[model samples]
Target: MALTQGIPNNIYGLHSAEEQFREKACSIIDADTGLQLHLAVTEAAMDMADVLRQFDTSDEDLKVAQILGMRTFNAFGASIKLTLSGYHQNSALILRDVMETVFLLDLFAGDRLLIERWRFADKKARMRDFSPVKVREALDARDGFTSKKRFEVYELFSELAGHPNMKSSWMMRPQRDGDAVIGPFMEATALEAVISEMGRLAVQVGEKLDHFFPANWDQCLPSRLAFTQLKLKWIKTFYAPAGGP
Candidate 1:
């Protein structure tokens, strides 16, 4: 396998990354080696999108669930692509949003009245009730600590990339000594674990809507989860149960 060397940036010296891409008509930096390992991860997410788009439902509430499902998976897919595109911070930022929506989806699943509240919430009501902190707190309270430690992961991404602060500067800097540029730079493992969780949660939300749209989900998305577990086992060949990008 050909390994990435030096700064694996899309941007070249006078040519901007966009211009370089336009000239080449495709990515100049080859990521096929890393990409092949993630095909299952991409496919799992894609399958969920397929389910959300085509599944039939008579319930109006389920239709609403479908829309939110689409939003959740669309953002999930965007985060994955952003990571591949070499925008780790931007990817983290988007993944943070995915986590937030997944939490909301879980809450909506249990008591969809909350969804109505959320849908009709004024700006002030939203800030007061549906904020990330409030939402995580609610989930932790409801699930008896399913979200207790998960919130820590959400906080990590939020601090590192979601909000502008001193810590975020590290995102633009290289791991080794060097200058930095507004990136399109490589970070193959930046959010691997969180992204794995995002994939699971995206499908989890889909499962909640299974009552609305009947399909053979157990053998489909759930089985993929069983096999891959989204852990990217390829990194260690044995340490992780599955390969990840």
Candidate 2:
């Protein structure tokens, strides 16, 4: 239950807005309230990492999937740290990367040949050849899971978070009254939703792999499922419109 255990207390120290703003910073936001949300996200990622570690990485498909899973875990951690430090914009961008990694994890889980080709292709060629839209479509067709709406939401959030447009820029801009603003604000509800999606996508990828390698998956399922249930409970309690009471 101690989610911060083993995680450095100072992971976000270097980026703290209070440290940077010194006296000029506006009132520091209390990130502690969302600690549980961060913990849930971290725990889910660590669970995935634990499951992947138990598998033999000698197989090319497993190796690539592990690599992608690890990357997703790292990004999940980074996004949480950034959000804690009041760098919500940066966190959003990282979440975008996490979204893509989730899609690729699913793709590579289903088809090893595609991953092999992607790995061997020239970097530039690979960049040109890679298409997330196509990949999602293929995954949807193959698995019968509709992800178009999910992808649309991901793209919208990514654009808002990554671009320098007026919408997102307001988060960090100062008011005409000389008040400093630190933003790209992430509400607890929004954070819960994002982390919930991340956890769900991870579990989905694991499920896909299970269909391919049932024996290898049996040992990991209990822990993964437990953590997933815990995450879902949290989401429903705090984020669900009718369930928060």
Candidate 3:
């Protein structure tokens, strides 16, 4: 989670803010906390990597796979880095990429569970903190798709999800896998970044609202959207291969 010093702006921070907006849009409570959701994502990722190595592919493909695998890992790490820096946009973008790319990979059913967990986390945040911010509304949802390759790679996960898992041994129960990834993957620095960013944005938005509007906008926003609805919407809008990064 320790990003190299002098890291730039927060892409993920903005993403997180968007997610909060979505949750507020629907008034849902996510089942997982930020820390818990983060751990679920990391643990599920490791589990997925273990499953992928079992396939016997060509050396060339394997090498490519290895690079992609590392990319997945690094994507998560980048999120942690953003979290530590308290950069909401950067951390949120990383988290969104991880979900759209690696977490959606269909290798392990655990990935599905993890995605649900993230939704749950956002939902929880929305419910606990209902303060609505004065958004620019200038953020074109289109701006999120700057990397076409990243978008294509994430879509592959949806394509793969069509195939069903046939083995019983691969199954994992939620309680049994509880928060295992938090300690290892959600580093202290990462946790600090996420909490700090969320808190900071809340303040910024609150001030903006107070400055522009006559009354509080807190009650108008919902906590979170339905998970399935949010996922499908994100897949269509942000994961377009033409503009994804």
C-alpha TM-scores of all predictions: 0.66, 0.65, 0.27
Q: Pick the candidate with the highest lDDT.
A: 1
TM-score of 1: 0.66
User: Order of all candidates by TM-score, from best down to worst?
Assistant: 1, 2, 3
The C-alpha lDDT values of all candidates are 0.61, 0.60, 0.35
Local error of candidate 1 at 58, Å?
5.0
Better lDDT candidate (1, 3): 1
Q: Report how far residue 136 has shifted in candidate 3, in Å.
A: 28
lDDT of 1 by residue, 215-241 (tens): 564534553453345434433432444
Clashes per candidate (backbone, < 3 Å): 6, 0, 31
- Candidate 2 clashes between residue pairs 3 or more apart in a chain or in different chains: none
In the range 1-245, model 2's lDDT, one tens digit per residue, is 45665656565654454344422212222343344544554566556665776676567756767777667667777865665445656767787786677777677766778888888879676666556676667777787876577568666765657787766663353332333354434344444444445555554444443333336457777766765676666566556896445
In model 3, what lDDT does residue 136 have?
10
Off by over 4 Å in 2: 1-38, 140-147, 170-222, 231-245
Order the numbered candidates by lDDT, best leading.
1, 2, 3
| Model 2: residue 24 alpha-carbon error in angstroms | 18
Lowest summed lDDT window (length 10), candidate 2: 21-30
